[model samples]
Target: MEEMSVKTGVFGGTFNPIHIGHLVLANYLCEYGGLDEIWFLVSPQNPFKQNIELLDDNIRLEMVQAAISGYPRFQASDFEFNLPRPSYTVDTLNRLAEAYPEREFTLIIGADNWAAFDRWKSPEEIIRKHAVIVYPRPGYDIQTDVLPPRVKVVNTPLLEISSTFIRQAISEGKDIRYFLHPEVYRIIAEKKLYQK
Candidate 1:
């Protein structure tokens, strides 16, 4: 008999600092969903959000790397950085599928993102091509009825934290030590990021 292949989870995000919330969702998906490994696909630039004050791609990648360092199953990927600007999910998925033929790719996204799925580039194609694992976010409710066939909504704990809130706190000179990894927090403070 041929060896069975393991399913891989693709968790894409800006990962400004890659807080505990992100880690928790990834861990829950990997453990409960039987995912082989979770890759954190760091976006160089998020088209939906303005990037005038966003951190450098390498800096965000470094933070994600530091946050997920010890986890063997968690990987920080810079695939989007290498791809063209304004990276679209469909394009990324196509490239990834072509690059890794043996691995199965599942799209991991928050329920809030799912709510705005129609706004994404080639949203229909994305749903048709890969499995979507939607995790709960604070204010967004999961509407599985509206999703396509391949999407699976996971009832994971909703984390109240967000990178936007963290950035705001940092800009206001408030401590966000509890929201991020110690090393990441230290790096942000030392680098004086988000402070105008």
Candidate 2:
């Protein structure tokens, strides 16, 4: 008899500072998404976006750790750190499958990302090789009627919050304590992160 593989949700992002919105959605997925665990795969940077204002890779990773403090089902993965720069989704998924043979990794992304899925590197191959779970975004609408066999849309909270918002608020000296994990907020406060 063979051991069953863990159903892991790969939630990749720069996570400039992991916020409560991130935890809320991931927790919902862990309980309702039929996932055993959710890994917050901290990417060195997003290839699609400009890499102008991102914090240090290790700093972001530490903030992720602080955010997921008590959640056993949540994790912070720096797998992309060691890999070559300009990390592509297809490459990450393929490498993850090859490296972690014991875990069945499913790519967890937003409907916004799904809308631009075709533009990603080897989109078809990503869909064919790995399971994808698309969650709702505030303004993004996902068409369930055209979903592929391995792709499914899960109804999650439509969070309007983002790291950009948090950063802007902090730079303006606004109180954003409720938006982030307590310890993460502490780190920012103590270090004066994002302060202008």
Candidate 3:
């Protein structure tokens, strides 16, 4: 009999502080989607959103590591750090495919990103090459009627939390203890991060 292949899910983002929303989504995707593992790819820089004050990539990665320590299926990857900018999803997917030929990979994204799929680099090529698993965002709706055949809209619960809101709360001196993991919160408080 042929060896059973591992189904891996790739969840890429800036992950400035890796909050509860990210962890919840990963857990949901792993359990409900039957994924073997979910890798959180931390982007060095996001092409969109110019005004966001991002923490250092290394620091962000560390926070993500601390936040996801208890989850056995969750992993943090820095694949985009050495790649050229602006980091295009298509290129990353291609590289991943080449690097891991035996395992099946799925791109995990939110519905809001899927709505703007046309704007991404080589969108058609990306759709042609890999499987896309899209989860729901707070306000975005998935319209499969217009999407490509390989795209799959997953029924994960929509969590209203966002890194933007978390950062804003921190900058304004509001308590964001509940929004983030306890370890992450402790690190942020100790480091005096996000305070303007």
Candidate 4:
């Protein structure tokens, strides 16, 4: 008998503080996208964004671990931390292939990113290396007809919640506890995070 291959979804983001929206979306993606597991790749650095006021890398990674701790199909990855500065998605995917040769990888992204795919570092190379599954993002247009053979769009829900909003709310002295996982909120409260 042949060995069964595992299909892992690579959902990369700077989860400064993993929240309810991220949790709900990953659950929906796991069920709807036919994924065996979803790895939340916590990037310590994003080339596209300013890192000002961003939480420490380890703290952000810890929040991710706490958020997905109870979910069997969910994982928190600090793989990007080992990569070079300004780690791009393509870099992580390539490194993943080298590190986890047995597991097949799928790149999960948002429709907004799909719209700006061409601007990424070697977008075509990424498509050639792994399957790309894009979930809907509010107000972003994804033209399904022109998608590549390996590129797919799944029916994941739109969770408008964002880490930025939660952080800003906390800074302004609002109790945005409902927007995050209980443990995540607890961790933030204990650390006095984002109190500005």
The models' CA-based lDDT, in order, is: 0.87, 0.92, 0.87, 0.90
Candidate 2 lDDT for residue 155 = 94
Clashing pairs in 2: none
* Ten-residue stretch with the least lDDT total in model 4: 44-53
Q: Which stretches of candidate 2 lie over 4 Å from their true place?
A: 46-50
Q: Give the 10-residue window scoring lowest on summed lDDT in candidate 2.
A: 45-54
Q: Candidate 2's C-alpha lDDT?
A: 0.92
Give the true-structure RMSD of model 4: 1.4
- TM for candidate 4 is 0.96
Off by over 4 Å in 3: 46-52
C-alpha positional error of residue 46 in candidate 3 after TM-score superposition, expressed in Å: 5.4
Write the residue-wise lDDT of candidate 2 on 1-196 in tens digits: 9899999999999898899889999999999999999999998965566667788889999999999979899999999998877888899998999999999999999988999999999999999889999999877888898899999998987778899999999999999899999999999999889999
Ranking by lDDT: 2, 4, 3, 1
lDDT of 1 by residue, 1-196 (tens): 9867658899988887689889888988888977999999998866667777778899999999988899899999999998977888899999999988888899998878888988999988998888988887778777677667889988887778888889889989997698888888988988988886
Report model 2's TM-score to 2 decimal places: 0.95
At residue 41, candidate 2 shows an lDDT of 95
List pairs with backbone clashes in candidate 1: none
Model 1 TM-score? 0.91
Per-candidate Cα RMSD to the true structure, in Å, reads: 1.9, 1.5, 1.9, 1.4
